[model samples]
Every structure is written in C-alpha cells, then in structure tokens.
Target: MPKFAANLSLMYNEYEFLDRFAAAARDGFTAVEFLFPYGFIAGEIKARLRDSELTQVLFNCPPGDWAAGERGIASLPGREEEFKRSIERALGYAQVLGNTRLHVMAGLLQYGQDRGRHLEVYLHNLAYAAQQAAAHGVTVLIEPINTRDMPGYLLNTQEEAHAICREVGAPNLKVQFDLYHCQIVEGDVAMTMRRDIAGIGHMQIAGVPERNEPDTGELHYPYLFGLMDELGYDGWVGCEYRPKAGTSEGLGWFRKVMSNKY
Candidate 1:
C-alpha cells in the first residue's frame, strides 16, 4: 500500500496558520509536508509535530520571494551563494523536525540569461546542496513544475529533471516526481515513473487540469497508485491538492481510495 501524506499548506484553510497541525491531525493525517515554513520558528514547529505525532515527510527550501514572482533561485545563475544559504537554513529546520526530504525549487530564469549558463549554475549549486544535505541525512528533491500552472518556471518535465539528477550524480539529489504536473505535461504516468523511479526521492499528486482532490479528476488514481504498489515505491505520496469543498470533505475521497484495493 502507498503511504499518503497531506500537504498542510494546501489542505487546511479552516484554522489559523499555526493551528494547521492540529487540524491535519484531526483529519487523520499521520504525516505532512508544506511549501515553506519560514515564518514559524523551527523549534515551535518541531514541538507541534512531536505533540501531534506527525512525521514531516517533506518541506521546501525557502524560495527568495513569492510575491515578487520568484518561485525559487536554487538553480539560477548569479545566485549560487544565496541558494547555498537557503539550503543551510532548510537543513536547520529539517534537523529539528526530523525531516528526511527537502524540495529544491529551481526558481525562474531572468530575462536575457542564457539557458545553458543557468543550467550549469544549477548543476553546481545542486551538487553543493546535495553534499550539505547528505551530511545531515536529508535527501534533496528537485521538482519539475508545469509551465501551464506556473509559467516561466525553470524545470517543467520529468525527462529534464531525470537528466539533471543523473548529471548531478549525487546520492542525496533526486527528483520529486509530482504526478499532477507530470500528467499535465506528459501522460503515461506509470511508464514514465517506471523509467525514472530510480531517480525519484519523493512524490506528490493533485488531479490534473483542476488541481483538486484526486477523486474529482480524470486521472485514474486507483491504477496509478496500483502501479506505485507494484513498483514497490516506499516513499510518501503527498496529497498536494486544493480542497473542492473543504479539507475534511476532500479527505473522504482519500479514505475511500485507501480502503479500496489498488
């Protein structure tokens, strides 16, 4: 069976931000992930996780500025030093939370920048980040965001992501294979995962097109999850989707899926 985790950032809007853990726990989630927990103190968050008995499956390294339209800069040129600092900061939080995975968002590219040069910068930064994460027993994940949802995003395909991971050649560096984005950019989910599963360190899902609860969309998650089972994937599959009605209502679908045979 595939272990499911909830992305607290996207799931709960009913409670105050700091109270999300209690809400997620009430919803029956044993593990959770978030985009960026920069505002809260790491120690406080760790305490809450401990009290709640929730495992931190994954969390993102802080991307420079979201409001300024910057998704991440970990792979951008001229920002190597900034990117390293971001990784270190995330490591600090990960250590406290007992998190084993960190998602590296390969930010957006600046205008007039050569793609090749940017990729080279990303390669070097990733290698360095991987080394740092390895020392802390954390795996660094590189995600390929679909341009349709996030225009001008740096990485957008599993093929490119897989190639980058291979080039990086670090045990701690791997792809965060997000099923929703992959389904949007490229179908044939099972085959693609099978081909690149070796490089995958984490996984996430939302229904394609709508980005809502998995049961509300066209992707047959039963089969997709079945494929994951047959592949013997042992990583957490995060539910990173928007709730159609509410977090609790959306959770019913997850329960139904979990109860059924994949």
Candidate 2:
C-alpha cells in the first residue's frame, strides 16, 4: 500500500485543529497533512506531531485571505509581493514542522480576466518559490484543482500543471496530483498517474462525484493503491476526502487496505 497521510484539513473535523494530529495518529496514521498551519504557531503544531509520533508530510502555503474568498494569490496579477510573502511564511512553518513539501495554490481567476496574464504571473511566482524552497531542501507543489468545486481555480488539469512545471524549469517544482480533481477534469486517473509519476511530488484521493471516502465513490481505489505500489511511488498519498459519516468511523477502507498490505 502507498504510505497514507490523513489530511487534517478535510478529515478529522470532529476535533479541534491542534487535536487532530493525535486523533489521526491514534487511528493508525503515521503521517498527516493539512491545508494551512498559519493559524497556529509552528511550534504548537510541531509539538503535537512529536507527541503523537507522527510525521508531517504536507501543507499548503498561505492562500491569501482564505476567509475573504481567496483560494490563493500565486496566479493573481498585482499580488506578486503577497505571494512571495506567503511562500516565505510557509517555508518558515515547513522548517519547524520538518515537512519537505509545500503546496502553492493558484488563486481563482475573476470574470473576464486574461488567463494569459495569470499564467505568466503563476510561472514567475512558482519559479521564485521553488528557488527559495530548494535552499531549505523543500519541494514546492502545484495542484490542479477541479473547477467544478472551485469554479474559478486557475489550475484545473494535470497536463496544465505539468506544463507549468516545465515552464518554471525548477527541479524542486512539481505537481500535487489530486486523483479526485483529476477524475473530474480528465477521467483516466490511472494512466495519468503512471505517465506522470516522475513529475508528481505528492498525491491526494477522494471518491469521485461526492468527494467522499475513496471506497464510497466511483473510483476503484484499491486498484489505484496497488498501482501506486507497482509504479514505485515513494511519496505520501494524502487522504483528502470528506468522510461520509465520522472520520474514524469511515476509515474501514483504509484499515482493510492497510491490512492487506501487511
């Protein structure tokens, strides 16, 4: 089985953010990921991870003004400075938490906005972020979010994200391939994973259509898990899904898969 990392951002909502680390650890998760750690001091989160004996695998850079409806500012024009600041802030947290991966969310595009301009800005920002992150031995990730859930999200396809990585020309910059989003935008999730595994820094999974637990949706996750093992993907597979019921109660699929591996 691929190494599974519980995504505290979407899972384990039953507990407070700080408490989710121990909750995930208690449930047999050796690694964990979250959306942002900016809300809490880095030391606070680091302590939780140490106490729980869990590894921090991934977390996103600041998505500017998340409460104000901003998904990210990396691809937005006129926010280059803020985007750079977000990367700096995220790197600080990553260093403290001992996480090597930092996801950079491409903010949404507004009505009638020029996508060409946004792409230019995004490429430049990613290059800068990657260069800075490399010095700390951290990898920068860009995820292709499905527009269905995030209508205006700037990045929406694996091809697009990979192309952006190529344009950025930074070795540390890679794709955060979310299988759930890939299924929505482009259906051949397995083939995409096999073909692009080299450029992929991390991955996330959820059931398609409902974005629920992997076992409850259209995607056949068992096969995908096997495929990850076959393809020699050594990165952490983030369980970024909304539990159909309670987080712990809905982990039967995870338990079964892990048992099979053992």
- Candidate that would win on lDDT: 2
> Candidate 1 residues 20-95, lDDT tens each?
8888888778899998888999988888888888998899998988888889887677788889899889999999
The candidate 1 region of ten consecutive residues with least summed lDDT is 253-262
lDDT of the structure predicted as candidate 1: 0.88
Error at 134, model 2, angstroms: 0.4
Error of 1 at 23 (Å): 1.5
Per-model TM against the reference: 0.97, 0.98
State each candidate's clash count: 1, 0
**Local accuracy of candidate 2 as per-residue lDDT tens digits, 50-157:** 999999999999998989999999999999999888889999999999999999999999999999999999999999999999999999999999988999999999
Alpha-carbon lDDT, every model: 0.88, 0.94
lDDT of 1 at 7: 90
